[model samples]
Target chain A: MTSFNAALVRADTPQLTRVINGYPITYLDSGATSLPPRAVIEAMSRHYELHHANVHRSVFQTASEATEAYEGARLAIAKFINAPGGAEEIVFTKNCTESFNLLARSWGRVNLKQGDVVLLSEMEHHANIVPWFQLRDMLGFEVRFIPVTDDFRLDLSNIDELMKGVKLLSVTGMSNVLGTINPIKELSAIAHKHGALIAVDAAQSVAHSVTDVKDLDVDFMCFSAHKMLGPTGIGIFWTRKEILRDMPPFLGGGGMIADVSVDGYTPANGPTRFEAGTPPIAEAAGLGAAVTYLTGLGMANIAQHEHDLTGDALTRLELEFSGRIRVIGPRDMTNRGGVISIDVDGVHPHDVAQMLDQFGVCVRPGHHCAKPLMKRFGLNATARISYGPYSLVRDTDMLLEALHSAIGMFG
Target chain B: MAGLEDLYKEIIMDHYRSPRNRGELPTPPAVCTEGFNPLCGDQITVYIDVTDGVLKDIKITGQGCSISQSSSSLMSAAVKGKSLEQVQETIGTFKQLMTGHETALEDGGEPEKVDIRALGELAALQGVVKFPVRIKCAVLAWNTLSQALSELPS
Candidate 1:
């Protein structure tokens, strides 16, 4: 076990302790969206002030500079994820939801036949499930779900049974609700052995730990920038080079086209073909700066910090609450991330959340967009307290105190 | 200890612990409407049996936060025996109250006041106005009632 004795560094994050309701705020809802660092905000503001021009169009110096900055961001993202075959394999979309929709509309429409099976896990966010459901309704494909065990882990014991006729396996790298980290590399290997392509939704995992796409050998992966201390409206969809070359274009617009005529149209190749119009230039630049910030701090260091925090939170919660609270995910930090979903006896989740808010402590209460997983666990909802790099032990203490207050009120 | 009393007042907790009209109605010529708040996973199913221009009976069955469930129970008790016009009028007045308009109704010709306590146990939810996120939970049942009425012929 890693001891959590690190200093509560307040140098990097200036807005850590904003006042809410006449009290210092404790933000524990980073799983919903992360607060951006000063570097990312400044980078975005700098782009808007200068070097704001359309790329790949003009021969002027401004256009050239803008194009270099935009493509440089792409390369930075590629290296950030250790994407094989360089920057061209990265396609920028609105968010992870849009990225999954693009794949469903483009590659899935072309490759999935009438009887082909599209396998998904029960722990998927609605973004991952709904697009495939829409595709199934339109394209006549079969949708199947991988069952979860009693402890909220993926039931890998029945992997062969579920992978019999699966053509494409879309799984989450880490469950947003349970915080259980799935074995993406092992799952990818299994999918490949069964002659299926795997696409991992790394929305929760990419922010907390290091994700090397090439080493995992996943066919496709998508994640959003908002969850990673960057601005919203920007996410990455990384596909293998060969897969990118073979798939049809997702959206047709100004940039994705090579040449257009009344008779025929030619589409641009690789990532450009997927990006249709003027991209989110400032947001992408901000995401690039966010990657730089994370790299400087070292993702491994952040992961270790989060792991220690999660362990501390669990130990404190279990010790204090004893038989009152039940945590939903793995009890060990070795197999989990920094999210903790908890249910209190005889207390509704919303009531718990409301009590926490009275102390200026923010948390999320609901199914966390995993209704099927909630059904599997036989729970209506759970109150979740997640952490980030800016979180401190004081925040956890506030949460514990507020929870106790809530329980007393109910009692 | 700022416990459930802060959010769930005595009356609200009473309705939650033992909800009124909680069972499902037999499938009759009833109009059924479902309400869901995606943000909080609060859902409700309301059934209205309107016969001969009167709301014969109103029942709701679902699971959600205490505010939502108790509000539904109170809503069922308020409009069960009222006519269609009365139900619509009460709904409009309740909507105004929830949206910060018409905080108090006029009383006996003196603009002095009409207490919302006259609105029955539903008045217990006034505390929800302080918590905006829970406003939806308190109003979900009324919204379902409006939907059920809208589907009727008048």
Candidate 2:
């Protein structure tokens, strides 16, 4: 047995914790939005304190510095995700949802015609599915979904058949509810072979694992900063430079246009074309700092730690609860991330979550924005406990104890 | 263990184990409306048979958490055989009670105290207010019933 120690476990430090949650709060909702680390918090604070000026207009020192910092953040993000080109290919948006929406509205509007097919996975979060639905309603395109197997893994065996006649294939890199890490590299390759471009919702995977746009060979990928221990209200969209240059701008405003007139207007060059308004300046800096921090700690280490935690939790839950607790998704940890969804017999997920809350143990309960997946699984909802770098064995113990307490209450 | 007593009172368990008005009423005259909490996949289909402004029969069928199921079970029992106005008033009073707002019915009135004994099982759900997220679960059935009544054509 591996003896766990609590002495070395401290998340976000004290100062950063104050600004975020106002106390030493145990935040297990990292999959929703992670608690920002001290470096990220300090970076944003420093930006406000020293260089608080708008970008791309004023010739003053502060304005130039602000522009440099903001553009520098773009460069950092591009590097972090291993984009082939420079920052020019990276577009900053409100969040992952907006990024996918941008692609659907702009790219889908231009490329897809009536009866054109856009394929998706059953495990997609609402963000990925809903945008396509809106596109289908507006543009009269067909949206098809790749079926998930009985074990909840994407059924890649039928990819060849599904990819046929597909204009674009959009899928999630990792399922928020199932914790299934999709084989994006293989999926993208198959989509390409079938003459289709692929867009990946990396909102869950990018933060927890090493992700490279070049390595995956995906046409487009989007993820949020907040999920990766960065500030909220900022996200990244990494696309091929040539594709971005060809696609129409999502939002047309002062920043996105090179020349505007009553009759016609031309869009600005590079990623700035997609950024319509004044961006979230401080938030971008915080994201850049977050990427820097993650780089220092090494994402591989974080992924390994999360994997260990998930594996241990899965083993213990199965052992302790026996037949009473039914874990959703793949039993093996190889193709999974750190998320664990479990249904306790005779106990509702809300009751389980509430009981866990009383013990100061946090876990997410519900469909987790994956209603179709829940329907596919024939379950209303399941309680999900997702792990981060700060999660320890004791935290899992607290969850087990609270779960037992909740079950005993129903008994 | 916090024990079953704290969260699920005996009354609630009783209602859940043996729910009242748990099936469907007759059609045409019965107004059926569905309530869904997309966040947790809690769904309820309320069937109310209103005749001449009086709720002659009421039945509910759906799947949800215990709080939702039991609340629907109790609500069907409480409002059956009452006039439309009385049903409306009871629903309004219950909404106010659940939200912790002051309700005139709590004091003396024509409808009286609503004889909350049928709501016996539902009282355990009062603790749901403390767990604010589950408050929706507790109120889902009543909300659906309210919709069914509002949709009635005078």
Backbone clashes, each candidate: 1, 0
Instruction: Give the clashing residue pairs of candidate 2, or none.
Output: none
Residue A9 error, candidate 2, Å: 6.8
In candidate 1, which residue ranges exceed 4 Å CA deviation? A1-10, B1-7, B29-32, B49-52, B100-118, B151-154
Give candidate 2 regions above 4 Å deviation: A1-9, A13-26, B1-8, B100-125
Each candidate's chain B TM-score? 0.84, 0.80
Task: Give the DockQ-based CAPRI class for model 2.
Answer: acceptable
Top candidate on DockQ is: 1
Q: What is candidate 2's lDDT per residue for A66-153, written digit by digit as tens?
A: 8888998899999988999979889999999999999998888999989789999999999999998998998897999999999989
Which stretch of 10 consecutive residues in model 2 chain A shows the poorest summed lDDT? A1-10
> Which TM-score does chain B of candidate 1 obtain?
0.84
